[model samples]
Target: MRKLRVAMIIPDNRDERRQYDRPEPEFGPAPAALLQGLQELPEIELHVLATTRRPMAAPAQLGERVHYHLLPAGRFAGLSGLYLPAVRALRQRIQALQPDVVHGQGTERYCALGAVFSRRPNLVTVHGNMRAIARLHRALPFTYLWVGARLESLAVRRAGGVVCLTRHTLREVQGLARRTWLLPNAVDPEFFRVKREPSQKPWLVCPANIVALKNHLRLIEALAPVAEKYGLTLVFAGGGDARDPYYQQFKARVAQHPWCRHEGFWHRRQLLEGLARATLVVLPSLEDNCPMALLEAMAAGVPVAAARVGGIPDVIEAEVTGVLFDPRDPADIRRHLQEMLERPDWREQMAAAARQRAAQYHTPQAVAAGHVAIYRELLQIPS
Candidate 1:
């Protein structure tokens, strides 16, 4: 049988070539986990395509079978939701690769649009709901979201199939796509392999980007009273450059609380280390879709106290796997945090259950097999 060629279009936030200094590895959890899983199948050939601000000598082979292509972006990269130049370039590259299937990582960016323009057997994975996200982050600039929604809708309508990372996303794109599949995101194995020892001091960590939807400000205010009563230490990790306007505001607010520590940004390794020492993981997002932070925390054997929104409820079985609270209610956030801290036995039971759930559902092998099955179904190939 002939081997199947696959082109997986993912984001390129790790543009090391653009950096003047030596670049750090930023193999984002989603792409890294998916690529690792896909590469294990000997019958498939995988190629990754991403958009970058500047051009570089790419189409570089990362592994035995996985190759990377970094397409150059147009001047109006951010202003224009979809970079037309990159889309044009990506279409050409996809033609050259002549893959049996073109898999787009997310609809939030230009990748999905590129796949749609290729007019190939394209499949898109909805990593986020732009229309919903736009509503949540109304305080910030919403031009991007408006543009993203339009492009995402077009891509979903055109793509041969759609992979919804969470049912939250599925519900929104129900009538948009011709075919759809529910597949949750995967966490890196490092999250499961980490060695954790309980911190002598009660510690909590929120490992989400400092965005408006993440509701970091509310989390800080809600935890302030709890921190005072329990002598708790909370660490906020993940965000863009510290100079970012939104981050600056977030940083100023975090600095007001003595107990809150804004660790700025930490890569996967650093985040794993923080998770190991954490007493519990907290996510107070106004909206979310199976966030990698929550999954990583569960895989690390740490119980999560997350907002009951998006695809979160799908993973967190309320009191079973982890505790769930209303993201809109700061009081609810405080209450759940207090419950997790006050009841050690209950926390332990939840943590054990979370670990079991992660092992069963979030492992790369399981996630990869699900994608492979979807691919085979799309191509009408025998399993």
Candidate 2:
């Protein structure tokens, strides 16, 4: 039988290339995990497409069947929603490959535009709901979020299908997309293998980029009193700009509270190690669509306490696999944190259940198989 060729358009982290000074391209956790899963399937040939501003010496092939293609694009074009140049370049390259399907990884920027414009049997995955986020943040005209929301609407309408990370995202995009599928993100296999050795001092780790949407400052305010009462430490692990007002505020607040520490942008291995030692993982984002951090924590057998907003409820069962709190209310965040901290046995039970759930649904192999099924359906291939 002939192999199914799939072209995946995704964002590659350029900072990782410069930081590590390596020739290999790095992707965000969810895409990387999906790639890991896809590699396990012998029936598919994968071609990964990414845009970079500067040239990096990346190999043409990543594995036996997975190939990589890098295209040069203007840094600001996609940010402003004027991504025709990037889309045209991507379409030209994708046409040459002539894959069975083109899967755009996210609608935040160029990937969705490129995939839809590829004029092939293409689908886009909505990782975050840009429209909801723009409203929540009151995004200014022509700002990244504002532009992204409009672009997302266009891509969803034009694409063959839209893959939603959760039902919340499905609801957000159903009207715009011709067809939509609720598919959860995958956790890295390494996370499932992390050796848990919880620190003697209880600490909560939050792995998310520092931004207003992520609600880092609000999280700090909510957890400060509870952390003090329990002698618990709160660790922040994710990237943030030094000049951004929100980032600066987070740093200033962390300084004032001796119990809180901002580690700032940890690599995969570092994050896994931190997860293993953490008593619990927390997320206080104003809105999210199946965040990779919570999924990773579940895979690592770490109990999660997150805001009960957006798709978080879909991933976490209240008082079962994890605890949920209101992101808007400091009292609610404090109450949940206090309850979880006081009950060691309950926390352990939640961790065990979460690990079981992660194994059943969020593994790379499981998610990969689900994606392949979708591709087959789109291509009218017999399952």
- Among the numbered candidates, top TM-score falls to 2
- Model 1 vs. true fold: TM: 0.94
TM-score of each: 0.94, 0.96
Off by over 4 Å in 1: 16-25, 56-59, 77-81, 138-142, 240-246
Displacement of the residue 346 alpha carbon in candidate 2, Å: 0.3
Top model number, lDDT: 2
Q: Write the per-residue lDDT of candidate 2 for residues 79-111, one digit (tens) a residue.
A: 543777678778989999999999999987788
Worst 10 residues of 1 by lDDT: 16-25
lDDT of 1 by residue, 1-383 (tens): 55789998887765532542323324568878888888888888999888766554453776779888777765555335456777888898999989999998887777788888886898998888876777666634447777777778888999999998888888988888999999888878888887788787889999888877788888888887768889899888876556767778888887788898988778667887898899988999888887888898999999788999988899899899999898778888888889889998999899989989999998888898899889899999988
